[model samples]
Target chain A: MTIAMTTSPEALTACCTPTGEPAMSEETASSLAAQFKAIADPNRLRMVSIISSSENAEACVCDITEPLNLGQSTVSHHLKILVDAGVLTREKRGVWAYYSLVPGALDSLAGALTGRS
Target chain B: MTIAMTTSPEALTACCTPTGEPAMSEETASSLAAQFKAIADPNRLRMVSIISSSENAEACVCDITEPLNLGQSTVSHHLKILVDAGVLTREKRGVWAYYSLVPGALDSLAGALTGRS
Candidate 1:
């Protein structure tokens, strides 16, 4: 909330000379922020754990509720956040929905953090 | 807020067995969640990028405020969160506090996410 109006990127680069160069463009920063925020909650982390470790690396909402003891609706909300953030993918099969990790998404994010992306 | 009371780990393991085994224990999940929460903001991500990309991989609060267009106090607050989460280490140099990444912290976190930890 304390984010003030940004000066141009050029202005920024000109002003800050303590480094060889700036990295992490504003666009990339915003993108990774959304991705990290998607999985920052305890329940969400637990969900990812359970699913990633589950059979076929996929899980149903019913399976999700037990470990975290969360309601289906609440779990759905968290899952939606992950899906929206591109962390997990959701597929509907009959009445139940299954969630799985988007391939290489987490690894790609990890690479970004280590500046190896 | 959706996090409910956890069942014993054994009960959880017994109930959800669609896989060879469980991964990412509650304690690890909680710890990683806190760490992810610490860097989930755009400004915070930008700060990390700035510092990691900077000279000697260290930066002062004064340098942080300009690029992110944030106030020094607000930047300090974010820095404290990263420091508290063990993402960054702070050093006092005269009147200024210098912040640098904890070596391998980001990589270790990345490895944990990819199950390479």
Candidate 2:
């Protein structure tokens, strides 16, 4: 595989320096883009800040709506996006559902942005 | 201000625990969301990977289009978005423009996401 790659004329291109950094695949880009898109909204980011900074880095949907002055349904929509993106996890306790950071999600994304990945 | 905050019942809310983490403001969220939104597309992300992994973490408009099989105009559009968001900066020399990450831009965004900011 290395021999085959080294033979390609593209190997000589500036994009393919021997930095051991492979260009991101379309798949990787799509997945990461989805995560980034999920948090690309201002209100959604506020939701993340509120939840991540909450006690135990988690909070209930009911408690989340008021501080941000958002309605229940709107907060839920943002929370759902974060959960789907793997940035947050949800747990149900009796009548209330709580949300918290998925742990290291942002750090990994940070690594990707700086090419540390 | 400290006394005023201590007396508010909302301060007692779980969203406002004593962790010293302030929820992201509308302005901060809007600015960050723009940066995140710029990179939220797959093609844009691939462009970022190609440039970031390049030698010295920078690349030219000419060299960038080929790796992703994108036309000049599309790549230019993506580059403009990145530049406008302050994630990447563009410098023109002679006939070519080179782009590089705004130093610590992604790190700071990462910090914002993890509430480290």
Candidate 3:
């Protein structure tokens, strides 16, 4: 695989270049597509939404699962997808993995979709 | 089969309600997921980016294929996905199908991803 994301700011530096307007490059298209694919799943989308609007804008896997009315494993699986997509970052405190929105992840994605800087 | 989309304004009316940050509901998650799914494909993503940045914000299938170096059938398939995702609106003028970005489609998607109004 080409790895999940660019993993560096330099990757996206050209993303917003060309000013005013430009066609999305192949790299940009693939990168943004991967991120969007992460949110493309209903389960992952639900999890990210819950986490984004949660208290402190972070949520433990346990807290996220209950309202979802889904099995623990399924929720975890979905969480993995969001984390892979770079939309959510995971921090393990003790036995729990707490997920929080990666700062600017949504804005970057929104920018990509809107062709904004 | 719940049809591809909600197909009603009432469906998305609740999309932006519950302001000041709130957990995304199941309906909201699914609807947004469906739209995201449309942009999830690499081919489709390339096509949308090309078409979105094209002259007049619209492009015929013929105009889209050459730059991407992809075959006509592949481009058409990608276009179908974007159309199904509600990102591109199609207008058949003579023997060609012309596609234009839906006025608020990108904004609506950006709003959903950003949780913005």
DockQ of each: 0.29, 0.33, 0.22
Question: Could you tell which candidate, 1 or 2, scores higher by lDDT?
Answer: 1
- iRMSD of prediction 2: 6.3
Instruction: State the iRMSD of every prediction, in order shown.
Output: 6.7, 6.3, 12.4
Ranked candidates (lDDT, high to low): 1, 2, 3
Winning candidate number (DockQ): 2
Give candidate 1's root-mean-square deviation (CA, Å): 10.6
List model 3 lDDT by residue over A1-117, tens digit each: 555344355543423233244456788888888999998877788778877777678877766777778898988888888888889999975456779999999999888888884
Question: Candidate 3, clashing residue pairs?
Answer: none
Candidate 1 vs candidate 3: the DockQ winner is 1
- Tens digit per residue, CA lDDT, model 3, B1-117: 555344455543423233244457778778889999998877777777877887678877766776777898988888888888888999975456778898899899998878894
lDDT of 1 by residue, B29-82 (tens): 889989999988888898898899887889878778876788988999999999
